[model samples]
Target: MEFSVMLELLFSGLLFTLEIFVVTLVGALPLGVPVALARMSKHKWLAWIARIYISVMRGTPLMLQLMAIMFGPYYLFHLNMGPDWKYWACGIGFIINYAAYFAEIYRSGLQSIARGQHEAAEVLGYTRAQAFTRIVLPQVVKRVLPAIGNEVITLVKDTSLAFVLGIMEMFSQAKALAASQVSMVPYAIAALIYWVFNFIVEMALTRVEKQLAYYHD
Candidate 1:
């Protein structure tokens, strides 16, 4: 194919790559909070369940996880998801995998918080919920921003893993074009695209970190 046409195909695939990144963050970032809370819960069962989940997610290969999710329904329930299942499986697998990592990051930030802050908030007539939402959450977010940014950057490249499920994300697009054209240019372009995407993410994250810098623990 012509260079222009190749670029168009790659960009087309980049759109889905971007979608996976956004959807994963949307589903994982907030979902992580509850998992982190559960991990730290006083209730042993909840903590154990969360702990085990985190352990399993972190310990396994994400590609394997994606495969399991993609094929799980057919194997476990004898139900076929048909051709449309790849998109759902891709989103869910990425979300759950990243949620585990984010949960650990959140747990670290939450643990870093001093217990005295909670007591002080209570003394100031703040309910537990108010205290967390008002004071604790902000500090935790600021503290965790760098870690989250790292994960966000990693997710940019991880979107390529969607190919394991036969999703035509950017990398897969480049791979296909390169194979057909017998040229490395497509792969080179894909690298540039990924780097640019990550650069934008880094810039945005740095801006947020600077904004959060107004307060320090």
Candidate 2:
């Protein structure tokens, strides 16, 4: 009975974890790419702002972000919200935080392409955007997939941080079950859930990287 209860609690928490992971990626990946471009932009102000956002997010603890995002409206503006708002707030916080890191990852990969490739694209009568999307973007995706895979895995674990915001995410559920049952198994079970999920992510990323292994310059 204890084991079954623990499993149920953990499964419930998994939903919240998955919610955070999905929503954050949905919000962040596209945004991160743009932020990367902005950080690498010719304009000083754009780059500066991007750099500062990245610094603040990367410098601060994620725990702090979780706390501030969850409580900021209530404490600062005295506004209360509904259930969906909790996820939205937490998802936005995680997305903004992770997007900065992803943006830097994107910057490095985008810059890794040989300058000659751009020149060749010009020689072939391709416009800058066309060359970037058709010729350069493929290689950039290949190069960044591995790093992005790592971040995705990290994001899986980071989802547990949502519990700090009173989200009843997997970690929170597991912790509650553990305390109530007075058993170590609930925590161990939660760990297994995370490990298995991460294993699946790693495998999927491995397949993606392999499929793009042509190494074209």
Q: Which ten residues in a row have the lowest lDDT in candidate 1?
A: 208-217
- What does candidate 2's lDDT look like per residue over 1-217, in tens digits? 5567667778988998998999999988989998999999999999999999999999999989877888788899998876677777798899999999899999999899999999999999999999999999999999999899999999999998887778999999988887888888888888988999999999999998888888665
Q: Where is model 2 more than 4 Å wrong at Cα?
A: 82-84
Which ranges in model 1 have alpha carbons more than 4 Å from their true place? none
Tell me how candidate 2 scores on lDDT.
0.90
* Per-residue lDDT over 84-121 for candidate 1, one digit per residue giving the tens place of the 0 to 100 score: 99999999999999999999999999999999999999
